[model samples]
Target: MAENPVKIEKKKKKKGLSYLWIFLIGVPIGVILAVLDVDMGFLDVYSLSDFVAIFILFYVGVFLTINLHELGHLLFGKLLGYQFLMFRAGIFSIQKENGKLRFSIIKNVGYGGLCAMIPDEDATMKEYAVYSLGGIIMNLLTGGLFLYLSAFMEPGSIWKMAAILTGGASILLGIVNGFPFFSMNQPTDGMMFFSILRNSPMAERFYESSLLTKKLSSGIRPRDLDLLKDFENIGDMHDLTKAFYLYFQEMDKGNRDSAEEYLLDVEKNLHKVPPYSLPAYYYELLFFALLSGNLEKAKVYHEKAGKILMKDQDINGLRVKAYYAYIMEKDAEKARTLAQKGLAMRDHYPFKGQALYEEELLKELLQKIETERQGQ
Candidate 1:
């Protein structure tokens, strides 16, 4: 598929720190006043120790608030017949592995998380609204309940302070995340829900694209897949998704030249994709270059991808490294070692289901290398 030059939507420069952090920080100060027996009318008598106590409790409130928000997403999504892909709270994530959830940690500097749910075939505006509203509703109700309960506690008590702090934090979370707004160039849950409610075209595209991605990740072949047909008002992520599927389809049908051409087109428009998606793009480019016998180009892409893969090592990258070692460098020992490592890790590979063809290619290469060694 050939892509024509299209005008990119220029994102407006966001001009403020996110409210999430402000709420997370500010709620603790209110709780400290209650704890110090210093009424809000006159707060001139609080000690430094009270401030330190508030700081410590603030983090605890933040942690619990984040977890409650994400849990709302997970439980509500599941209730709506959405398949659970993963649950992330802050830097920690739990992903499905061999029919079980496995915990893993990653570096996420921001104070946010997500519950990735696979869209159902019958998904519509109702599901979208419900799923999006889950987290906010959780925050509001939990915060409200805590605040109400705190009213029953005696003044200057530890329980009163804790309840007030937690309630304030949860309310902050609800207010900040519940309202529709963009943060760091990404849409918030409320924004996404509002789009669906308003019948925006982009909302439908986002929904379809998410479903397609989940289907592909679950090992559905490209021949059975159908998505990304819309061209008008398509965003960069949608374009990347289409390119990925089309390139894989071409490769699966043994059309190496067409796959290479399509990949080159994707490379030209790579700036459309976000930074986190670059590793996959480079990996695909390297794979295609190797198949096309363009060793030098393959090496360049390999180096580019290696920098990103250093943070989150992958089986595909390891397999590519093995192929490069054997084919380009002619280092049989190094190739064999890397290939063995890739093959040994059966459950660790994230995209193994979707990359059946790639896995087959790696196995074939390993077998061929062994045959050559035997011939020697």
Candidate 2:
């Protein structure tokens, strides 16, 4: 088993202190106002009684919103040559390794699934564009459905109110996820990108892909197909294979600057991409830093890798960080500190649950560092 990646699980703070306050915060205020003949008191009681209606509205809104968004991502991704791994919601239960994609569903009342697309790292911008679009399309469709449903629902009744809330939610979900934020050039935005190219160089590439994809295909021969033996890794199966292949080319050509520049772009798209494939793109930067014999750059890359690994709370990442501290940073003391921390962390690793490999490496690295320090 691999080590878990989460670093610290912070305790959740109590909301409004306690559940007993649920009544104090709600009932008393209503009683005081009702005694005063205030309509607010009656409305509060009425709303509380309508919890079932509100709950249903919220649930349907969240589910349909997330589901439609996910479908939007899937459809666009597929259209752009990305292989779909899973459609589960909320935090992406879909897992992929090498070329195999697995789907898993996770659910809870009033919570929507976090649909994910774990495509190959080598997938082109086109595939990414579609994957992003899939979510937007889903949201748009849901919003439209809700809008349509509102017509049949009575004007101010519970069903009508639910329809209005859900429809509005769907529209907002589609629009928000479509907008580019953080690093991800959201699927909806990508659709917009496809629409209004402006005068950027990316526009030309888009035009080429749009025109070429219509007629261009590898048309692999039987012999060529034999070379591509892994049906699972086939282009149609996972786009990361292509992304990986291109990453290598970018690395081989020593496009270190270009590689670093592209790395951020990929990270933003990482949300739509898989976790495993993400590091491969980062590896391109790691390779660049290593090849240049720039210890500082290497150290930076190692720390970046550690952060990624830390998300899984894997002890191995700590071990890797330790090795970087010792060898690259020439800080044996800090290395020792990190080593012990990582070893302790291994106790809870999800995979293997042991730091045998990292421990061995740490020992070897510590010895070498000590030897070098002693020689000085």
Candidate 3:
């Protein structure tokens, strides 16, 4: 089916409200700053070099703050008996694959940094809370320390300026991340912490999802995993994690109708899906659209996800591109080459189950392409 007009209008209205919310937040802060007559003397720069140095220092501070926040999550997660699956700073990532650490550069999709850790099978809410709050605590402590040390340094000096910038960045990071808000559709540390404290269904779903991720990372296929057996209890079928797990489970079990239903539901709420996962989501929609002979809808999805499909190095991204090449563009050789590239990365991809699935899909595409060519 084509995209729903009413759903599109609702999505537009939601986006408008998001912008309105930002404006509302900014207006109060601006009014307060103006009313307080905030001093602007510190920003005075006599030379271009000075301006450049200040800019560089500011970015350095931001970089350091982001890393520290992620590091905080790592440390706390480890303390809570959670195992690290991946750590990402900007577009660079270190992932655990087959019990080995592998470093790679990835396409950045809005996230500044992330620390992905899976809790133990018997993990409790207290542990989850601590793990969630770890980053905020680190940020607050470091921010305070930097600000204090800066006060001891000579005003306007490079060292003092650097300290001030870093300290300010750290404090802002703490405040922003500690507040319950969504950053690019992913919950903040503070959000997660509070949710866990409240013992919300979302928190439980998140915990279950983490366990599911751990299993996937351990080379277990979705069909073999029992972590999501109670997925219906999540109370929100539209929840991205729940929908994704259900889709994977049904797909792995060869229930195409059930899988497509989940994907279509996800399509209706694409705004809730994280940017990093958009390519995969769109890929699934596009793949199913093609299989169901909905060429127009398939083309629309392909176009919508074109940028990511062309540039994304992930196995799923490659698989979609290959599928589109053969099915839509009718470029058999291009499809085979793209599929082969995805197959080559299967061993090193972070999620073993996903990698294996992509490998199988690619192989299937390759076989289809060869059969079609032979018939021609």
Clashes of each: 0, 32, 0
* Per-residue lDDT over 86-153 for candidate 2, one digit per residue giving the tens place of the 0 to 100 score: 45565345644223454444333123544434344355444545555666677777788888988988
TM-score, each model?
A: 0.70, 0.41, 0.73
> What C-alpha lDDT do the candidate models reach, one value each?
0.70, 0.51, 0.77
Model 3 reaches what TM-score against the true structure? 0.73
Winning model by lDDT: 3
Candidate 3 collision pairs: none
| Model 1, CA-based lDDT | 0.70
| Residue 71 local lDDT, model 3 | 94
Q: Who wins the TM-score comparison?
A: 3
Ranking by lDDT: 3, 1, 2
Off by over 4 Å in 3: 1-56, 78-109, 120-125, 179-186, 225-238, 303-308, 311-314, 373-376
Off by over 4 Å in 1: 1-39, 109-111, 120-125, 152-154, 157-162, 217-219, 227-235, 254-353
**Model 1 poorest ten-residue lDDT run:** 7-16
Off by over 4 Å in 2: 1-45, 48-60, 76-82, 85-88, 93-95, 103-137, 144-163, 175-203, 206-250, 254-281, 290-303, 306-376
Which whole-number lDDT from 0 to 100 does residue 159 have in model 2?
70
